[model samples]
Target chain A: MTPSALLCQFRLIGLCRKWCSSRAFTCQAAVNQLRREQGATALAGRVDRFGGITVDLADVGLPKDISETAFADLLTDSLGRWKSEGKVAVWLRVPIAMSRCAGAAAARGFTFHHAQERHAVLSLWMGAGESKLPGFATHQIGVAGAVVDESNGKVLVVQDKNKTKNAWKFPGGLSDPGENIVTAVREVLEETGIRSEFRSLLSIRQQHNHPGAFGMSDIYVICRLRPLSYDIHFCTRECERCEWLSLAELARTADTTPITSRVARLLLHGLERGFESIDLAMEELPAVYSGMFYQLYHRQIPSS
Target chain B: MTPSALLCQFRLIGLCRKWCSSRAFTCQAAVNQLRREQGATALAGRVDRFGGITVDLADVGLPKDISETAFADLLTDSLGRWKSEGKVAVWLRVPIAMSRCAGAAAARGFTFHHAQERHAVLSLWMGAGESKLPGFATHQIGVAGAVVDESNGKVLVVQDKNKTKNAWKFPGGLSDPGENIVTAVREVLEETGIRSEFRSLLSIRQQHNHPGAFGMSDIYVICRLRPLSYDIHFCTRECERCEWLSLAELARTADTTPITSRVARLLLHGLERGFESIDLAMEELPAVYSGMFYQLYHRQIPSS
Candidate 1:
């Protein structure tokens, strides 16, 4: 029979089984009590796939003062059976409060895999071909700008050395440590020699597969900038060319990327209906936004 | 048998049944041909105790140009039997991309409830209680400060009028519209008359069951501040009293509430080791934090 017909038949049978099994389960409770007189093997603590068992120790806070011998004995007794049964892997997650047990974990061949504020994950492989992975994921935080000179009908644009010929957009670069309010301003100055005032934060963008930055999640913040000087002193190393382009020229240019074009359009729309800029370095969000953007789009602000 | 023992027995039975059903499902694929000869009724879909049938229409993007007669006929055919069957509630989630067919939804007696950026939720009720609810869930975003006088080994604090007799911790209040960087600064000034400089964000706390804020999730961003001046201008309307207390005093005070005490401790800890502050308004998170946090605590941050 066809897959669709088979699926329908399976659904019908499954529905019947669902009700019948639930009833049967309730009725056979007494029968189960009798069956329990004969020894039955107990099931493992978790779901398994590809010959791996997951044991959650999140709630089971092992006694802090337990001896290393006691802990090692417990691990061997619990997991040795599974290993002998040919289980290839085991996964354990421990809460951050119990981080003191890392020494105990290391004794059992378990190694730290990754961590967050509240918890840490560790993995053990019984049948491994030499595990050689980093203990933690790497990440990079960055800031970019969409410097706008709406009054002069111009916007700061840059052509990356690596991008297509004559492709120009906003000037921004990676944020350095302690570069709070001046990150975007500094980038704009370095890229196009324009001493710009960081007007408002436009959006934040994430690139998980950033080519050059492997094993790193690249975070980019796009900001709205107000330019103070128009003198062009472009960086030769990073950009092939940089200039201020009018909205008309930007819309008409074939070299402008879609992202830049869209940003321009959004800025044009925002300027028509002014902008209520969020002060990134200073402003705290109000207690009650009776009717505002936060609720409308969830708290995730738009970004690059 | 005892509850614990009974539970263990059930687990064994469940494991055996899992293998049996999976094997049975595969074997039955070959034997269900005879059942096809018998006429089968189509499945309406899920049944619930509350007499509600949830039919997700997110994938079924109705044509924008579909006629009113056609649209009404379609909805009637789909939901009329459900109504006659006495189903009292229906939920429909329409994605933002498919919002053009809102007219048809409204025509069919659907009302908007809550919304996120990607989608909007709407529900229809034929039950006893009159449904006077917004089509989307409402949320509030707030900012607070954990202002520190690190050099002096003290922190700004206040005793809220609603809290216990002498509970004093950090001075902060609900954020207001356009009250960005100056939120904590403004709050500190208003609460303790300390013109503080906003430094870094310590953490974001969420309270789903905030008193008086019914059906609202209160999101508060706790910030770190550098106090420039120390004067006490307590807001008598909101705060009973305000003061600057040493870290030792804060740690010693038993009257301080758990949240305030925790915040104080965290701020104290952060002083020894500075916080890695992310400016949410100007930062984009990488997409790769998946599986790092959600499963670690089943998706909710640890909050008191």
Candidate 2:
């Protein structure tokens, strides 16, 4: 036997011994029986909506000691059975522990679909000419806070240090995973040292093939925020210039990006009239999933 | 040697034989020399802004025949060198071919960060506190289209067959990867058989802990559309009811979702005034990346 297989057998024996300290012979017999059963059983999987099978290797409990050749044999058998059953697609999720088997699966025509922290999912279309499966998240969310000091009709803006043009824009960055719009306040503080609170979501810009987002689409959300602190301790590494500029001047400035200038004009209108004239207020409501909630941004409903 | 390792060596010998058919002795010598050089070379990597080293194993070119023990030894030496150099974090990217090395890296404190089609990225923090490395995309974008017939002051709506509440909502679904807002028009037609054209992006809702999105966040975008075909051949599998409801009644009725009611009120305001009063117009701008463009949606700038 290979060293890895021997190591795995030893580990299993150790586990069994711990479970049944008084009966060593019985424990060894049980381990042998379990190995036999494992070899005989087929890879467990569930049929998806499209008559496809999804096999999560973590749930399959791959034997740690199995050689690559052994894995290939098992996969070959599984594929043969699945083909006979007329499955259209096969999704195999391989955990890190069983990554050695990836090459075996790949050789059998499995291509990567997507991956997460714990595992990678590979797919194969059995019936079709080409796979019709949709790709995973292709857009990145960027949240920017337009920190407005309503008292003076001024809005906080910054120019990036790394840019050639250094055009003025709202302080923001890519939203962290699982972050809410309110997290824009933290980004504003980090970039401009201006403490702020999220007031309302103002605008959303959807763009395709954003270079900064690893060639993926980008969704830029601009939220109106009320400033809590008005200090200019800007981040030297991120921004070359930071200021609270007048709304009118910013609206007409050629030094700013088109979106920034457009937003500035919108803020000017809000300052002149009530914010209710343009604001898309956010409301938290229970999501379809029990115990989960979602924020809905829309025009404020007039209280009767 | 294991069967897999011997197979890998044979493959290399085969490749070398094809490259140099004239000299068998020279080809064997070159292969042996290459293997010796590979064993001595350290894994190559680059430093990030946070003083972290990122090693892409694809670039490292791990030998196909290398054993897990050899990988573990190489990782141990590299970790000791990095720790001595005062590196804060280590980002290791292992391609599918080299996934067998993942367990070796994980044994030395590495954990999964994110992964893509080609490879999986694992990270380890050697810093004083926790790792500041951000996570990958955590939000799914759902696009909905509200097809409005201006002549009749009516909007197309649907009540999902699967939903218990059967509340009226805009006809739409999850936006496909790399899809633009214009794709919402197609979703409207698929869910309800009314053809429509994209008009303007009305509102965006950002929510967290969405159940349908694999426990990730969700961003729901609502776009106003102009209907081309008035006939409603609603999808029986998706919707129980579909109709062109009067905008005024939709704004007042409790039969619809809160967002639908709120948007209906906004539409009413737009109908009374001009669409310019509420519409967030889209403008395509040249992105920072050359030859690429992005769409920016915001309140229309008055033409001077």
Candidate 3:
């Protein structure tokens, strides 16, 4: 029989086993004995650094025709062995082709970790107390550049073509994956066609359930940027208008976003009482992970 | 034949059709005719408010045994039609049972949008230019509370039992999904057994590629909190030590993380110059989404 036909037969058997839960143990034992006789590979897995067991079903050489009942039996037996071995967590990856097994895992208390192209990962904490697993990223970061020409006392701003309000705001966009705060410089260059260099992070706005972020929280960072070239050449596709407005006038204008007006006032304060008063200076520090580093932004400590 | 056996037959036919690209068109036409004769349900979808199409395969009533080739053909035909209809984006959700269709969709330029337990979502921009679809969340928010005792000029701090370095730091933890900065209050209470109320956001630290965050970026927010009760009943499992240390001493000490030390000085600055000199006060504003509100953190605007 073709593999697909065999799969059908196994599904039928699995359906029957589901209705006869009392006989499941005997059926599972028989299947296991048959598998041993056929020299079929046992479910394979590896131990993670955290003493957790990770099983990728696609790479485990599962029989294409294995029934859900048999798979569940194998999983239960494995969990019992792993628990005795003091495994802390179990990470299970179920390929799309063998997705029927996900239900079995879920019934055994597995919950989703994250999903990718060809598979879905489920996790369970087998250790004592609450699960210590860190969750998936749940916020999007948007970096905007407030390009100020100190010589002229003007700042570059734009009105997006797509937005209904068309309120003047800083030229900005979402930060790409693995991008740094310097992404604000690129966003400014793209939207207004002006080159700038990142100086210091000025302000951060944290909002939850952002409409544009597809129901995720948003972190908007405004950076103080020093303009390199002062010519205006904005992208017509993204912005309706772009200009260099007087910083003082922008701060008092009613025709801009609240954030823009607020940042304008902040820039005014920074200008009058030194940028150090408002700047969250970036400092690179070695991360806990050896040979790796991360950027830390905080108030600059005055040199003693 | 059972649905599973029919699925197998579909796979065999799809495999054959894949090898015969020249005859694939004719085969697809025949399949379409067969579908019409059998009165199979047409692919169902809805147009979102943004003029994008969303097709959930689980709810679309696809044939139980539809071949991959046929699914691909249908998707291609749909794309052409939707493009002519001026659809901006196409959101396709494929359930695990029909994940074989994912490859066919990907070949036509569909990329992963996000994934969930039962289905994975793929997206394509059918508009004039680049896809405007917002990306999935890519940063995790960690909120920490620095609880200050105004009477004694002391701050609450802790050293984690699990970390190699038992450095003094504010008691805090990861923000739960949809939780506000006020989560810091809860985390402080849980870790140090001190009840506190959130006063103002003090500082934000943005870091990328956090080791503990599964390769995602992290945003850490620190909030100033006032102590409600000052009894030290720390959770021994999570902390090695907890104490109320002098604010001035923590700022001058070398036995703490750089961030903690910097925040200590910031708090000291606040003590001397007033918190308005450093605080990012929270303001609740109506979000663009009707009936929704979001919290904005920025320098307080002085009442005119």
Candidate 4:
């Protein structure tokens, strides 16, 4: 595929001398350069493109009353017009969901190629050369806190026991069965004895089937929090130590994980912007508990 | 770094001889096996962790009456307590905005290590051993369309002219400054002549300082559209040819780009979900234009 473009062009141009003699016109940029230099030659000749007209029959709604015979007949009628238009190859892709379309295609000359779990690939070659079909390689809300000592410019992380990879991360885990605010407060409290007030929603990270998440898609929402207490008691189940790290100290050895480090960088940016806050106020709980999160935490906001 | 954990653990247990001689404990699971076998040996050693604290002073509201000397004194006092607690390192990360804090840190023994555009790293080592601080490696939105011939399970892409790589992509460029609806329609019109109606938002892609984007942060908002006409006359400035490809055809050869294929897969998933639509009539737009966008470029609908 890398050489397909220039090779296809060179075969049309009939100037594959450099290509055949030295096998040196390998680089794509160089091939494009040669194509540019020989623009006149390219203009003089018609492109010998891999000739094909693929009829994709997946998800398309066919006439509800059209018989399979009529579908085959319609395709047969189109083949003549396609040949008139100088298309020498025909590729018909039949989606797994469209068994009727696959039947109609099989009634014509199209043959089976390969398939993914989602869709099946089929092809009908009207030309003499080979056509390579595309290969199919297919491969939660997570919330964490950027619990900063806004008074002292320190971020809190717990020393993790999970094989000492970076050994530390922002202590909060995925949101439990509660609102983001409640989860933030509960996680921060559970992991570190420090009490924190949620300030605003900070950042959202999306991962699609990431291995770190056991091949699950998850969204991680990082919230900004203001610390209220000083003493920290580490969660014995998850971490070995609890640390209050400076933004600079975290940046120096911030290899605990990429997402955490990314969150740290953003936290610094927020400090630079003077920490503009997002408000969350309404909650059904008592003021002592509900007052902890940002003003917008308890209510849903409209999408922009 | 992958094997460093097990190697470091082995060093603590005086099992370096067996590890180095055998060279068999290579996989992570194997190392975990060794750890399980020598669980008691692991328990016998006291864990040694590099200890440090960083003071971030950027956005934190320092008392208006306190002088830099008092802040320095506070940090110095913490140093003695940290040392008494067996902490061997002290780190102070000063944000670029916190110049005054950097001055106070300089008054102490904190030396500059490295810096990112947003923050500076500085550290003080009180330990008996070497302290290696972590350096900073710092590293946008884009919108693209997954134009599907829903009846035929085909996707539409244009052969790009810029390079040989991923020559095909859904006919799209960056959106202009107007509403995403306007940008979607306009960019689509400019690239391909097929008139389409904006259905709803498909995906939001954020490209931050990407090389293709001239190192600017941008958000790419993709919108799904229903094609009204079939003929496509490609824009000469950007692409060479316009094509309608089936999912199987794309799967067989859809190497236009990773993101494009990802969108295609998502589009297939969307089709499986019967292509659920997102509403947008409530946007702050004149009823005439927004109405036209949704209603075949000619009509209006009563909003629910």
Candidate 5:
């Protein structure tokens, strides 16, 4: 069947599932449960399968009018509208006086299998409210890297000429244009000639404006690597030299320019963790958003 | 009223309206008649009351596939499980994948409203897929600009010490730290001594390693201005001289530079459009992303 026809059929089946799955009492009980979970934490937690923490916005002492569940609904509703057609959308709630828009979102049709009882109550704070530093436009491409062949808690490093003060650092660069970020991880292996496989992204450092003779050098995504082949040889002209050093001894080595304290700390932690996936969460999100989680889940708009 | 109670009330009112406004009809004939009266195109073209455009994915040659919609459901379900307090909801269907994502968007959700009706189909194409480029994290803090005085179809321009080797240009500079963008806009006004107000973002231009320049410079939301006052005063530090040139004379001016081509073209079109509100859509977006129209609306994961 044509792709369109298949979709139509699938939507039909999904509608049936939604219909069959719900009972009024169960939905109502679910709403009550959501109410009990309300708190002042922010709701900007990652929506991954593994449980992530939701901050209580009120905990931060921001506007505390909205219930956590209600705030969740607002965000969820916005997402529904934004990502429907591959289009990215974002919503800003500003004071009516400052903003030209006075009207609230129009009600779209939604099929509710279950009614969510809770709502968000946070009021829009005025005068330089929360910063959505990362707008919706930045596309996040997944990337992975590794630290290889550790002998006595030491991994690998390379000295480079281009960076500030010609410091020793991990041998990696950005993913090429149209290159899969994951694939780029492997390229590090090909260039360095040291057999290394993928590891989790250890930390992300955004250097808005790097301090040096230069202005802004851009942010770097640091990764942890594991060794696949031991003996190392420089296969590319990108770096000057390579070596593996223990964290304790590495600090004394000036091969790498003085890494940021944060980077240094992460490196130490990675050594302790011994290569594991690390979850990165925005620690700054307010908690009232957490209270709004329920509304985000169950509110449905009409199907076009 | 309690925040949850407010939401419950809104939902209740919506439910009553649904039941009272339309009688339930199960027959295919009734569905067909409704479709005919509304016309699929008309129905599809309805502007989302909340925000954004809604297009039937089926109408646009895209469909919701079984695997993708099911996956979408999984996301909602996953979000619900992670939050525990409230479910993550989204506006379903209102397919927007074929368009650019911008403006007011919340989340992406897909659902099938009826079993008998065609199941919505989602066609998943391979690869990283096209995504919108993120603007600067700093730029999102809002922009400030001036609306210059009525120039009678003539706008003020300055010959720059750097680029003036060829053309006339708007007088402005990078925003300083701790100052709001609007403050920067006002600063430009004081330095230039020309009254103006912000109109809209004109465009974002990033030229890497241009013929003469070494680094990238971002363009700003162009402001329109009234001649609060005018002076022939030259800021010897940056500008050589200020002049108000008519659009007709801009091309013939000996001092016009290569970059002036873009400025001229923009001015010509903007002037033709009566210079009402700057066409932010045209300015802020690349030509490639302009064609897309619809987006995903709202999605909900039933609290199971």
Candidate 6:
């Protein structure tokens, strides 16, 4: 890293330390509260974020305690927070022993975030010791989409071509070679010409349900954007149609699929709040653009 | 990149293609706009981002426009955009004819981002009447801090070690070799035992204004984080006493630095946003981590 970038990072760390130092006392207070009620399992998962669901690796059940209901609440809360303050995704691994209970989650139709490779090894290491754990590698990637036009209570939607005709979707794609999710969103826009802005992170839709898709799709912090201009373009003939449609119109669209429900809800709710554009620092343009470039020119440009 | 990772990426590519097909029409709209805008040079001088700033062969200034307002705007925008984008520096060339104009930027109090490297290079072409543009490399970096408490509002703060213990600062040190801004942040946190969440990316402070310290300082993305837990881990004592301070109480302690202005504003806004955490795919982690580790520890650690 360049000296300037290094220095910038150092500054953030310092703040984290300082923040932790002050919160140390509070953590101590909560430690006791957590220890009393949740036992070791509850205590382990005590880092409760309001409107944010915390997966308790200890329980590992389908339709886990944090279900669609909890997810919706958390998502709403998160979207509000993300509007002004951008959102971030943090991926961490729980030790196999700590995460073993999560394995049972599959029976309830719950899937571990990185179940195939990372979680697989973790489960084996914890349940069957080192000998039984299959050796493989895994990585978690987060991709986000920015809703550029949510004017007239209608969200801008892109109809993908590779899939069924008339199906509505978001104007975003997958991560690129050597790029991250934020970049992926930017790339999709630059290619698709849907001037978008990030709104709130939608959901981390893993590949379990869509075995056809494979692995996991870490949908990033979604956002609502105001397209400066409506003229759409395709760097390549990737998508069939990009349009601005009202939430009700989208619902009534004959081609709307069940998959679009989440996006529909997000857009409808965002429209009600009257989304605002977030200030983007010029310096940040490079990363955003480059990230998009990586996604477009070099990334696994997403399909229908 | 490993073979498995490559395969996984291919799968993702297929998914992207399908997504693109579904949204082809929307993409065409954006494509038209892009075609119209292509003739305009407003997008000129813009760098190509390939994980870092890349000065496209076409955009790097030719001699005539070097000292023009457009030139300055391009440079300023580039600097501002890249800096905010979290890039350490930008690489470009000053056409040999524009060598005379180099002083123009310097005269305007604009300094090269990096002082250690040769500022410019002269190149000779093999063809007749053909001359190569001279080259220059400059770099910049920023540092950020997040102050948080367990209650999600407290963080440890300190007086600058270099300063006379009057200017309150985060307990972070300069970045080391082979590290990104995030790496720098991690290093500082490891040394300080402070856990931080990335918040709003702050300004990329000018390095010329290094204060009493040896190196320059820029305002990075500073944030407010909730401390999770703390341990007395040390990477050698690098600070004076560290204290947890509430955001409300920071100003009461010492006059906050101009660098901290954004942080203070963010705190006052009562915005709760999480900082960005990098997402690397699970199947690709070993190789990615290994690449970094190899550079730093190849000689130290024996390959299995």
User: Second chain only: TM-score per model?
Assistant: 0.48, 0.79, 0.79, 0.44, 0.38, 0.40
State TM-scores per candidate. Answer: 0.31, 0.79, 0.79, 0.28, 0.24, 0.31
User: How well does candidate 6 score on lDDT at residue B117?
Assistant: 13
| Candidate with best lDDT | 3
TM match of model 3 to true structure: 0.79
Candidate 6 structure lDDT: 0.37
Writing each residue's lDDT as its tens digit, candidate 5 over A1-83 gives 55654554455444443453333234434534444444322233322121212222323222322322343454454334334
Q: Write the per-residue lDDT of candidate 3 for residues B1-304, one digit (tens) a residue.
A: 8776776656654543443332435555666875576454335688887899889877665653354568877787778777777888888887654555655677777766766555667788877777778788888889999998878789999999877777999999999778887799999989999999988888777677777676778888889999999899999988999999999999999989988998999888777667677777777777666466667776655554
Instruction: Flag clash pairs in model 3.
Output: none
Residue B278 lDDT in candidate 2:
67
lDDT of 4 by residue, B169-205 (tens): 7776653222233356666767888777766554433
Using lDDT as the yardstick, the better of models 2 and 5 is 2
lDDT (CA) for every model shown?
A: 0.53, 0.76, 0.77, 0.50, 0.36, 0.37
TM-scores of chain A in all candidate models: 0.49, 0.81, 0.79, 0.45, 0.39, 0.41
Clashes of each: 18, 0, 0, 31, 138, 100
Ranking by TM-score: 2, 3, 6, 1, 4, 5
Instruction: Give me the runs in candidate 2 sitting further than 4 Å from their true place.
Output: A1-41, A46-54, A82-90, A125-134, A159-167, A233-241, A252-255, B1-39, B45-56, B77-93, B124-128, B159-167, B232-242, B248-258, B272-274
lDDT of 2 by residue, B91-143 (tens): 89887666667767777888766666656778889998777665566677888
Off by over 4 Å in 6: A1-151, A159-169, A172-223, A231-236, A247-264, A276-304, B1-147, B150-154, B158-189, B194-224, B228-241, B249-259, B268-304
Candidate 3 error regions (>4 Å): A1-42, A48-51, A57-77, A83-88, A94-109, A116-119, A125-132, B1-42, B48-52, B62-89, B94-111, B117-119, B125-132, B252-254, B272-274, B301-304
Task: Give a tens-digit lDDT track for model 2, residues A201-281.
Answer: 887877776656645678888999999999899999889999999999998889988789888888888888777766778
Per DockQ, the best of the predicted structures is 2
lDDT per residue for candidate 3 within A66-142, as digits (tens), equals: 44568877888778778878889998887655555665676687766766545667788988889877687888889
True contacts kept of each: 0.00, 0.44, 0.37, 0.00, 0.00, 0.00
Q: Which clashing pairs does model 2 show?
A: none
Alpha-carbon interface RMSD for all candidates, in angstroms: 23.4, 9.0, 8.1, 27.2, 25.6, 32.0
